[model samples]
Target chain A: MSKLNIKNLIKSFPSMDRPAVNNVNLDIESGELVAFLGPSGCGKTTILKMITGLFQPDSGDIILDEQSLLKIPTEKRGVVMVFQNYLLFPYMNVNENVGFALKMKGVDKNIIDQKVKEMLELVKLPDIGLRKPKQLSGGQQQRVALARALISNPRILLLDEPLSNLDAHLRDEMRDLIVTIQQKLKVTTIFVTHDQEEAVLLADKIALIFDGELQNFTSPKNYYEKPKNIKAAKFFGGVNFINAKKHNDNLSTNIGTIHYKGENYTDLNEDNIITIRPENIKLSKNNDFNNNSFKGLIKSVIFSGTHTRYKIIVNDLELECSLQSVGLQDIKTDDTIYVHLPSDKIWAMNE
Target chain B: MGGERLKIILSLTPPLLIIFTLFFGGIFYGFLQSLGYQPAIGKYEINFSAYYNVMFSERYAKLFWTGLGLNLWVSFASTFLAAVFALFGALAIRKTFFAKTICNFIYSLNLPMPHLVVAVGIIFVFSQSGLLARFASQIGLIGSPGDFPVLVKDKYGLGIILAYIWKEAAFFFIILMSVLQSLGENFEELAQSLGANRWQRFRYVILPLVMPNLFSASIIVFAFSFGAYEVPALLGVIYPQMLPVMAFEFFLNPDLNARSEGMALSIIIAIIVMILVVFYFWLTQAKIRKD
Candidate 1:
């Protein structure tokens, strides 16, 4: 069965101009990890809250597995959410917190004990049963939160930026923990995060939203490669947006003229915006192919350990280009070099 | 020392000094003067006999224990009733405009109201020849105010309780509403989403969440009622005075020994209040552990 179907869901707080989740429509399948990627106050969490039955939509319908979720009260909706702050009930220890759902369900204590142990093992925190939430580290508390939600064998898992509070290293570790546990559980999980890297790393499908509106929803790979508009393109790490004007068999941009490599280039368009990922532009002298290249003076270069990012000022358009040290050609500031932006890497978004 | 430490210490000292000077100092002064060794009483020696006589005198002992028992009962009953009603008042007023306005008015209404004046008002409303009696007579339930069973000055302390709840429940509502508001809206929503009904959410989530505030508020309310004089005096002053009223009688007695006995009774009140504080602290710690 299709796990979730939301039809034109709309919710608004009082005194607001419009609904927060305005006419949101989507379908979520079983056993798929979807990420709601958006900026702060974008109503991603609101949609998640509605899906989890924390909020009743002002209008419209939500169907879960062909059942109208509208009539069902929250607790019986078979959805568990992990909050952004981890929100492990501070008064409860690891085991008690994790077993709260089972307790609510009135499962036998002995069965709850066994299942809690199993869930703990799955989260790799089996030894932390008696420790309170404050005693554990952020990652540990996050695991406890995950374990708590998973103990009930929920039909779907809703996560609202569950790793937002962790530090850099802990964030990375917990990101992997979420993906691993989500896969093993095989439940329809919606992971929410504002960090594009985290979303890309963990999401099987990403729903990019902006200002309470869904921009594009697709797999992370497809989203990054084929953004539907300029907003989606900028949301990701792709920085170079060159206005391309179609000229016969080629397109003209700020970095100079470029030949269209894809088929059906004859369909001329003036409003097309060419987007290039910062890392896609190659800087070298090997003369790889008969593709397009920008010959410009390197204005600045920032060397991060694995890659050197260059800001090349060409024809008043500053293009960000990140190249690995292995592909280095001893380029410095004021050096005239050819930065190759492959036709495959140059994405033209129709906005 | 760090600049932050200096700033924090400076900011916190005013409250600490105020509490120590007023409450702690006032209580210590009261205890010392109650021992019958005060030079103002012309008693230079610390006399155990005065304490012994104060504790064992037939008339004084009867009044002391009876008032003590009644005080404890009134404090507990009002504390419980106030807490229960305050929870309703707190929960009833969500972010709604009407509820907010009503809650605010109910809570702060007593701020400008004199407790003695409220006691008089309570007596005027609930006593015989009071509004209830008048209304009852109009409805043909009672023939006369004299036949109204005399709730005021009847020695049962029922009117005292009525006065206590009316005044104290409002204060409890103010503290409780603030606590409930501070605990956030997400928790109840989250608990409900996890399958808890309203009562379940209240019992498991909201109560535990606001228990610390509830406990402290109850203790303060209990202490206030136990020590209250004006309400009891206005309601039942002549029949059988409360401990504070009885203490006032001893303090103003013509005999010197009765005054010393009053001092000793004050000591006993101090001891009872201390015990109440100790128990409150113990229960609070236990609740924290349970949480």
Candidate 2:
């Protein structure tokens, strides 16, 4: 296992004025799986490509175990990527594809065969070595790609949205398979994905990127509960923003003032934005629940399978509130309700 | 079902008749003549005498064998070299933007040019008294134009081979460019990441993916080059003429009985081309099955 460090990496295409990857810095510890989570065109894949030596960075250093990787070519970098389409060579059988890297290294045939068989068994496709890639299903092809990538014992594995092409059920299965194999091999891996759930489920730490910048890098729990910015906050789930003016200890807003006391702010200021998650805001008919409670009208009720989401109109501000469908009574639209905004859960940050 | 079948036959009749008359009809007449049944010469009995004379008889046997060897050499050499050069050209300019546009323009510039014109151009540029010789003499690189290497009308058939390659490479490039464009660099990138070097990537991945198209395109080039006359006639030496040129010379002979021998040589060239094409197809099919 080797530590992968990316220091101030930047890249810009000649066709575009703005750089594709802006001075991004990241440190992936040895044997840690980090997921680069972002929307489309967020430079996740571009950064992955640069790390793998497919794309050259305009400036900065990719230090792997205290050595710069910029001078090394792609094949010598010991970084393998499982492409989104699982680009198995159409001319080779599954075994040949899996053992290609070893063959390229001029390994003995008997050893390569043994390693390829072990890898096939590891990916749980043990008896289909002679079958061509097109003869396999989408999920089976994914396994072949995985086995091929892992058979070479790469220093760092890069997965470019490996599960996006699979069906929903296959996505879950492949996700589990990847995590299990990643842990077993203990290879330092970085995976790019637009799906937040996959990142959270598979990564030890998630790096949220937006518009070619790393917005936040932390654990999945921190991303949801304690996001560093509005962008990272909105990525995990829905967030309702309200403009507020801070006065010493109390913050004044359109939904009425509340004694706001979240630790996101150090000094009380005039201009601030208050963001709260929909699931954290409790809706009830009784007013004696919490300190920062307000009377509101339910504007709309959306009944999802897992939960019922309500849009509550308080004064001129609309706040989205979600309640679990289990152990909850029917909440109708146009009904009067009291929405509680917990002080600690309401995160206040400067605009 | 009978009515539908009749409608289908009616719809296909016009094309079938045209193909049978213009294509197969010519082939049938040539085959009859090749077997020594030229009515114009008053030789009505159909036998294998014309074929035997063309292959083994004293008069035309040496010329026939030498022409066959030249035909094979020109077709195989030009096809192989053109396909290899075009594959490299296509790969080099596949990704770069400015180079891609410029190279695409230069690559297809000769596609619309006639082979005879290209042969004439080659002579003007490559012959002993050509522009290159003049330039070399002007620069004082050699004593005179005679010191310049002979590239055209030489015994080794270098002039005809060069002209064929220059013209046919563009055809191969066009086919390869389309294939390369449709197949993005994803596979190459994957191979690179999987520890395959540049040569390995091309040999194991890029070549195989684009091979079927390359083989089919080479077949067309080979068959065409084997039977094309104008380029070879314009730029060839008289000692070992290409098969097509030799066959056409037989037709021009004053003796009307020689027409059967000419047709026999034409039929021989056609058979060789068909055999090569079938062999190539069988090889590609076996590869596909193995894969």
Candidate 3:
């Protein structure tokens, strides 16, 4: 059985015209780290809050271990959330902040002290327990907040944009710490983040939401290659979308007939739109001797440090292709190249 | 930077001059008088006789000690009770939008009201022959109009304390409401997620967060209540009056020598309040360091 199951969750505020969270459902297995991925105001945090009982769902059932948690109060729900701003109590030192949950539970002072030391060590922030929160750096404060949340051994750990407040380098360090501690403890975790890269890097599975609706929930690789809709694909940086018609084993678009061999196109209607990742498109000088090949002119080239992005105009369609910077010295603007969209790499969705 | 400093100094000169001349200057003059420098009476020699008389003299010693006790009682009780009431009031209405708006309007209504008006209002409502006393007599709760309890003009300074609490709780409320509203529910929610119950959240999070502001505001209320003269003069009894009222009584004496005693008493009140403030800061700082 799943460790946490959210069934038909719905919530709305009177000030909003639409529901803040629509009928959203998810099932997270024990010891699996999931990311609620969405843009701001997309109801990802709302679902996290609903699970923690901070914001009660207008209607739904949140089940943990086959028991409904709808009626449980926030403090009794056995769930802890680390906020985006690292809401460590300013008045308390790191020791008191980290050991606060245990103290509230009436644990002995000696045990709480021992556990706080251990938790701090887990976050690689030991010996700073005597310092107040304001005295520490941002990364230190976030680590302390993480240690504070983990001290209680909660059933579920929720992190709401935990890395949003950190700089680029610190975010990577904190991400590694979160993953290491999560895997070591094998605790069920759910984090809310709008950064697609962060979601892909940290989450075992990503639950993509758009406008308060659950758009797709799948693995990170699947979200890149096989999004449920165009919005999900666009959110993951999918810019090459071909509006086409699927006829048996091939797709017909404004450019020409394109041959694809994917079972996903079978259930798709005749009128559809096909999407392919930029990295999946092959750009070669020689004409490939296969299906799904087209002659195109390179319109523009943006050479980023890691990869070189190219805008290729193939007939009436402008397809974006990214090639690694290793051996791309030969490709430049106005070069006629052969673009090949691999048969298996193409995913078609109903328009 | 030099230009900015010049601008700041130029702008601040007006207020600085006013404060130095009117406030500190007045205190200096009063201190000189308290030390027996009454030039109006050709008494140029300065000494501590006024202070000694106020403190250890046989004639005024009993009145001085009892009046100091009453002043301390009224100030401490009113400041503490008003703070407690205002804190709970702020916390209760912080999350309710409609109630917060209405309660804020009603709570702040007492802020601009003159303390003298409030004292008179207390007298009208709580005095023996006041409106409440007459209402109680009509309802047969008491035997007659004269049978009502002596709530006002009593030895404990209940009427004076009531008036101060009623006026000062609004000041405390405004400060607390702004702090609580600006803080929002973030800290409380964080505490709640840590498995802390409601009371624990308040004790550990809310109370500590608001303690500094509450303490500072209480000091203001305490100092004002201890030194203000009108409320106690209107509501206090003939004997064992508050320090401020007793000092005023000495000033009202026809003898010009009595003026020095009144100044001495005022200076003593100021010194005591300053010492208490410093002690309070030391205590809170020590507690914070320990934490």
Residue-pair clashes per candidate: 1, 0, 0
Interface RMSD of each: 2.0, 1.1, 1.6
Candidate 2 residues lying further than 4 Å off, grouped into runs, are A245-252, A257-261, A267-270
Residue A192, model 2: lDDT of 93
Locate the minimum summed-lDDT window of 10 residues in model 1 chain A: A262-271
- Against the reference, the lDDT scores of all candidates come to 0.80, 0.90, 0.91
CA lDDT, candidate 2, residue B168: 88
CAPRI band of model 3?
Answer: medium
Cα displacement (angstroms), candidate 3, residue A31, comes to 1.0
Residue B110 displacement in candidate 3 (angstroms): 0.5
Top candidate by lDDT:
3
**Pick by TM-score: 1 or 2, better one:** 2
Model 2, residue A192: distance off in Å is 0.8
Instruction: State TM-scores per candidate.
Output: 0.87, 0.96, 0.95
Question: Model 3, A1-351: lDDT tens per residue?
Answer: 139999999999888999999999988999999999999999998898898888999998999989899999999988999999998898889999999999999999999999999999999988998998889999999999999999999999999998999999999999999999999998899999999999999999999998899998899999888888899999999999999897657899988888877677678888989999999999889986577889999999999988999999999689999989996759889999999999889988884
List chain B TM-scores, each candidate. 0.83, 0.95, 0.90
Output the number of the DockQ-best candidate: 2
Arranged by DockQ, best first: 2, 3, 1
Residue B284 miss distance in model 1 (angstroms) = 4.1
Error of 2 at B248 (Å): 0.8
